[model samples]
Target: MIKQTQKINFGKRSGLEVYPVSMGAMRFPEMDKAIPLIRQAIDAGMVYIDTSRGYGDSEIKLGKALKDGYREKVILSTKCSPWVFKAEDTDDSSADCTYKRILESMRRLDVEYLDFYQVWNINSPENYEKATCKGGMVDGIRRAVDEGLVGHIGFTTHDEPENISRYIDEADWCEVILLTYNIFNQKYKDVVAKAHEKGIGTIIMNPACGGMLAENSPVIADAVKSAVGISDAVEAGHRYLKSDPNVDTIICGITKPEDIESTIANFKKPAFDAAQISAIEKAMNKLSPDNAKVCTSCKYCMPCPAGIDIPAMMDVVFHDKVLKVPGIAKEKYDWLTGENNKNASKKPSECTACKECEAKCTQNIPIAAEMAYLARREEQSWK
Candidate 1:
């Protein structure tokens, strides 16, 4: 049994006590199998359940899981797009769009009301302005609140660091803010602290950067093992995120029962001290220089024209080069090339050197070159 590691009073006026770790239902394999894992997390004291319209059948799975009194035990958070752009605009159209989306989410989740409904992907000030305009999405949210369909208003974003500050500053009625934050990019730290100061609860997404920190990360593993005497790298990665007081909760996309068990085991450890944090940081800074060029698996550079799973390929490269695990890398590369892969058999060998993916990269990585290099390396290794 996992003791409640930490619970925060969410939203200065909401009077809701929330666990500092949220169960993210974004990466489940099958609903029937996923339900037990969800229940296991709840049993482990992680009761804040986060899902979204975009997370492929995740809401339906959650709806099924929450049956027989589980719904009432957790704080449910879901998101939907707020914009309804039509060639011809009507006065009440935007509100109607937002309301319809909320209703759709509720129906999908088989719930009467949402504890928290977020305006998804608030990426810029312009997006914010459009969402809060007169007769816009905020009006729709207000209507839902009055009708008891949604209890509170919140938003999720992937905007630049400066824009995150802008969102927090302008978030007058927001009860919560979900944003990308992890040990890799601590730029959001100050903005998150500012949000906490304003009584807006903060939930961090991508704490492991879509499993990057948790997978074959030797630098982080060594650092964590040295600093805290914890041999599990994933546990140390999570502990680093939980150490921040400004972080009210962190949403980890757990797929298996073992994932929850690991999380519970790590949360049992107290937050890292100043010296420990410093030591870990020092250890991490000593990683191979090329390791920084490796894909963070954020998928910010996505929707490739050639349909290549760029981040996945880059993960293979990192594993082969830095992690010294060529067999695992080759196996993962094979998985990416297999028929069952959702993105199709999009091997790096298929890259056309078009440089389109590079343009969208936040890290400005030479994606085409890397793709070519991976292809050559894999071909030679196979032969």
Candidate 2:
């Protein structure tokens, strides 16, 4: 069982105390249909709210919703697009004009100071140069700290694990690190441990693996061995990080109150038996190096009103996981529905914005919104 809350104290010598759980507002306005959801998260003791300029209008509404003294109660962190760090307007090479961008993010956030201001998407060597150059991004971050415009300088990355490990080793100035992490995508396995050892706060991103695991709840359960495994499935994931002791927080993207409840419940009893962890490993191996679908494929989400078999959709999605491929799944999707006569069924267009499917979706995919987008974009002639 989880013996404690998920939050941990971060040191950059920065006195930042936050909930072990953070709300990533990347899907802000989209999920912002109900402002109460945001309120619910904060009310639940989620003190960390992460946002980025890349996520259009997310930070804006986040700023708006965080009114009524909400700002003082929480730790607000946001990132600047890498484009801002570039000197030329047209060119967006890896080198960052970090010094200038932090100032802008401050203006955009309408804050005198930010708890953390990261160089958004600084995931490659080119990005490394931009941020850490002699007169690069780090200089600006340091200046911001001196100027009292930002508290600490952090960076988020999606680079290959080994390479990122090297960068972390070299850039001793980094106080916090954000990266893609989850059961399905455990690329930074060791580096995360290493970062914590270095006293750098490890903030996990993509913990849900893009809603892939939410779909496969029964599979997730069945895959776990009763003995010798981690604790609960949710805690299983948390335990993976929490065990490291270096991880400061897990920044999960949550759009509803239920997600917050579920996440907190896991924290309540975070435990992982050796056997359960092994089961998950076996399941991952079965997923294979190739032709693997990370989602557990549990039909927790049922009754999609469009008769859009959710599991079946994932089945195909798993197979055609290669985004570059215009696979049979797309073909099937088109055949099932569209303006042209096919199965006398609904196309993505047939979806109404009632969002009934969203509430039922274990993964909580914004189906109605997605369907509308897919339906409206059929002009390429899918004949």
Candidate 3:
């Protein structure tokens, strides 16, 4: 059992306190499995629970899990997706549409009120405009708060750091901010600090870089071990994020009981002092020239119109070049292209330079060019 620890103030503006580590319900298993996992997390002191309407059936399952008095122990949050409105009709961006979405989310989650409600997926300038435009999603959430349906309103983003800074500057209604930050990507580090200075609660998503940092990388593990005596890459990555005082909390996607156990155990470890944290950061800096080339495998550039597994292809390249393990890279490439893997729908050779994947990439990688290079390398028998 995890012991209760002193809670930290989420932010001066947000007016909430919570554990330093929280759980994101994006990867929860089926209903039966999810219920116990949710209960276990809350009992173990991870009391901030975040979910989204965009996550398929997640709200429904969470509603079931939070029953039997489990709801009272945690901070509950959910996001409203404006793109869902646009898909139905452009007129649906109105406040009425957002209010209705909030109601639906409440009904699904079986919750009377939410601690935090966000305008979800503000990924581009256009999306930011749509969400904040006259009588838009933000207005709708404000309406809910007015009527006691929400505690605080905020936004989640995948936009570039400059755009995110702009959003924070303009969003007077925002009381909290959720965005991606991890060991492999620190581009948002400045943005997070900026939000902290403004007294907005900062919750970091993708602290593990969507499982990329969790994979066995002796190079990364050794560097972290040398600096802090922590060899597990996943734990090291979590510790790195926790070392940032500007960050209020980090939301990790937990799928199983063991995941929760490991997460809690990792958080329970003593935090790195300033010098140790700096040493680890310097070591990682020496490993990669720029974060843009490092893929977090967030899969934002996914569902390729041409059916390419772009993350898998990028992972192969990452292992080859960054991790300096050609053998592991070749094995991954084989598995990605192997016929036995039912999900291997398309290989890098099938890439047509559509550029759609490039547009949605959070890292701004030249994905088309990388695809072409991978295809050529395959032709040369991976020489």
Using lDDT, give the best candidate's number: 3
Model 1, 1-383: lDDT tens digits are 56465677875745688887778988986877888878878877778888887788899999988998999989998877634222224323267878887888899999999998888788878888877888777788889999999999998888887987877777787899898876656668788899888989889998765566656656556666877788776676678877888888888688887777777677667788888777666665545334466667778888788888888787777766776556667778888888856555577878988888898887788989888888888779843
> Alpha carbon lDDT of residue 325, candidate 2?
24
User: CA shift at 15, candidate 2, in angstroms?
Assistant: 4.0
Which of the two candidates, 1 or 2, achieves a greater TM-score against the reference? 1
Model 1, TM vs. native: 0.78
What TM-score against the true fold does each predicted structure earn? 0.78, 0.69, 0.80
lDDT of 3 by residue, 236-332 (tens): 8888887889999889788987877887678777777889878877777766634535777889998998888888888888776677556667778
Where model 3 places Cα greater than 4 Å from the true spot, the runs are 84-91, 289-316, 319-321, 324-347, 351-383
lDDT of each: 0.78, 0.64, 0.83
Whole-model lDDT for model 2 versus the true structure? 0.64
lDDT of 2 by residue, 41-63 (tens): 87787778888766666766666
What residue pairs clash in candidate 3, if any at all? Answer: none
- 1 versus 3: better lDDT goes to: 3
Candidate order by lDDT, decreasing, is 3, 1, 2
Off by over 4 Å in 2: 1-6, 11-13, 30-34, 83-99, 217-221, 225-236, 290-383
Q: Of the pair 2 and 3, which is ahead by lDDT?
A: 3
Clash totals for all candidate models: 0, 25, 0
